[model samples]
Target: MEINPAVTFKHDRSIMYAKRPKVLIVGAGLAGLTLGMLLHKADIPFEIYERAQEVKPLGSAMYFNSTTANFFKQCGIYEEFLAIGKYVSSIQVFNEVRGHEFSMDFEGQEAEFGANGYIVARPVMYDLLLRQIPRERIHLGKKVLTMDQGGNGVLLRFSDASEAEGDILVGADGAYSAVRQGLYAKLKKAKRLPSSDDLPLPFSTVCLVGQTRPLTAEEFSDIGLEQCQFRRTIGMEKMYGWATFTTAQNTVAYNVIQFLTDETSKQNDAFRNSEWGPEAAMAMCEQVKDFPIVSGDDKELTLGDLFEWSDKNHISKVMLEEKVFKTWYDCRTVLIGDACHKFSPSGGVGATNAMHDAIVLANRINGLPFHPIAEEIENAFREYKAERVEWVQKAFDSSKAFKTMTGQSFASKATRFVSKHMPAWLFQRIQAQTCANRPQVAFLPLHNDTGRIKPAPQPSLSVRAPVEAETPVAATTATATTTTTEVV
Candidate 1:
């Protein structure tokens, strides 16, 4: 069915969506949620489907700086985030024996970037993103078993024997995304998929992460401080590493990473292939219980205390894989975040990069013409990739470097020595480059860049006039047979 373009106005923003393609997102993750919020703001029709019956707070905590702060302001949740986030002054790194090695100070970030660094519990951040959209739009327990897209439209078959069709399909799902699998299967059969994309994701690190229950000042003195207590401990002779952060909720979030050598990675093939759940998490907890935690007030603590205080059901153990797929989209199907690129958690930019993917993709999608065809949709996908691929590669490389620096290999020790002794001027130069690309929603009124250091150019930005009234203007420039189908 041929449909005319639609101009939907909400508040002060007006966006012209070419037929307003019904977006079917296959994951309600950070990337998916960020995309949904932008589409919602533009009055574009979209729905998110998650395989989990209920979303769990699996990861530990996430740090946010200028990279994503503007998007939070665009979503009108910046103030809320500030309220829940614990400001981070610096991240202190120590040796296995509690001797301070080095520190990454973020003291002047507020003045330089217009936003201070902050760390919040992953669950808290997830909840903040969840509340932006209407509850009815998110369909939980809808596991997508298969996906197919033709020249005209896209379709999804869920595990419950139900099906959904839309003009566009987004694979925002995680590393093992079913949507990606389906797309790759088709590409492989047609002899179009790249050989590297066909390989399984390789990994050298496994992580266990969780957030403890709220504690009193007596229980954890660091919780009383205004600044986030971020600490990292690198084992000297052991393969294990650990970190902890004090959050605004009077809770401590911790992560334990075990670097696996070539032999060890090969040895854990069975465990790596098995599904991860509470049982896997509990078993890992027992293994890393003895790892020491750096705390203020000279108090002694260990990973076991945090694990004990945390709900066992919330802790998660998963492999940290780093890969950027060569193929991101085909026809009406595309991907975002982990579905396309998976970065190690060492850089603390995995979630930030995921949301960045969503922002750029949404901007490109909003620029589609009044009556877009398969070619046009693919063009938008290509443009999105073109604009984001460079940044994604940079993030992947940065994350990998950090992962190597924290490993127990001899090369890791050398990298740490060089990093610890790096000149302050050179270090700041690298830091400046890393924080230079802060993208925002283009169709909306752009957030004023108040940072001293300007952000990198955003090629996907599409500035449009803001609507003046409450009623939305609908475009009716097509034939009488034109119809709009809303996804239920």
Candidate 2:
């Protein structure tokens, strides 16, 4: 089949392609699934392997901020997202005794960013993204045992002894990423891995999260409201805190966090293939079940009520690890999401940053020449890191700041005071920075920016702009497709 020469489309500036490189993505979480969708839109050949036997409602809720809204529009999923999520304008904060401390209002965020942020249950968000990819491309229960890259391509060995080969490997497999472990093992053997990369992901907090079954308006008075009711309470004497967000589904998503001491954090530094199971979730739930919620009603509503209304299987417990690795890629292998930087959930930017990582990495991969050499591949990876590392650090610091604000430490108390009294201009500036890094699929038709503040410059958007050919160009290989949109 020949593609029409007159058909206008974007073209890569790099080497001409005989075929697109095949990508093997480890993990079907937000980052990997997002990259898969972008690659598919770019007509790149790729497959995703998830270690889980099935995708579960593992996380509680995710906040869709301005950074990701436009990409959702580009992917044609913005409407669906809005349908399943509750529009959030502010986060109300409270002290341990339930006294209102202050509110972090995002009142003009929509006007400034051209998109409103939403809070959606994790399962609902996951299902929405999962539907964007072809069923056959996602392989469940296929855990990566080992991985290696050569001058020609990359190879993966699964726990089942099955093998797969691809031109690129992406480690979007979360905090205890096996792909990262394997890649670091190889790098360490060659003495190329940095000393910091050898250390475990230090975590200072543990979190239990879940979404309750849909409740009647009578059950949760806030459920009847059009806007999301997001409330967080910091423990006064206890070293724990809790939050609840009402979703569009009439379900309540909640999280309870246990702030650990330095000694406790060090002692609990360990990795697990299954981050949390039913037993562990249940155990944590029992500990925080008595925690009070700011559910507006005069009748005291505690976490116990939500826990009782939630599905036992849906609850999850996870460690909140904060780190941004210095090394992101080497040879044909690269990392994204928690694999590279694991952020605390305090800022609610973990998932957003993960998807942003997907956007940048996908843009880089789409620009690669077919069967690119190690140097070319490494160059692309370097660009990806350069574009993302600084932003990731910013997000890490932001998350840490928020986490500290809710802590019981003397520093945390000072942070809380400063946060409550923070100037409006400084607050607005920080909010702008949060929305400024919105990145979209560079190989696809770009979404027009509608926000008042121009987004921070995205290098990929300009460098990887799709070009229109004046004449007929050769089609891609059978396995790889080229995505094109007709000009109106």
Inter-residue clash pairs, candidate 2 = 5-471, 5-472, 9-467, 10-466, 10-467, 11-467
Once fitted onto the true fold, the runs of candidate 1 whose alpha carbons sit more than 4 angstroms away are 1-18, 273-275, 463-488
What are the Cα lDDT values of the candidates?
0.83, 0.83
lDDT of 2 by residue, 428-464 (tens): 9989987899888887778988899988878766445
Angstrom error of the Cα, residue 437, model 1: value is 0.4
RMSD value for candidate 1? 6.7
Worst ten in a row by lDDT for model 2? 479-488
Off by over 4 Å in 2: 1-17, 262-274, 465-488
Worst 10 residues of 1 by lDDT: 479-488
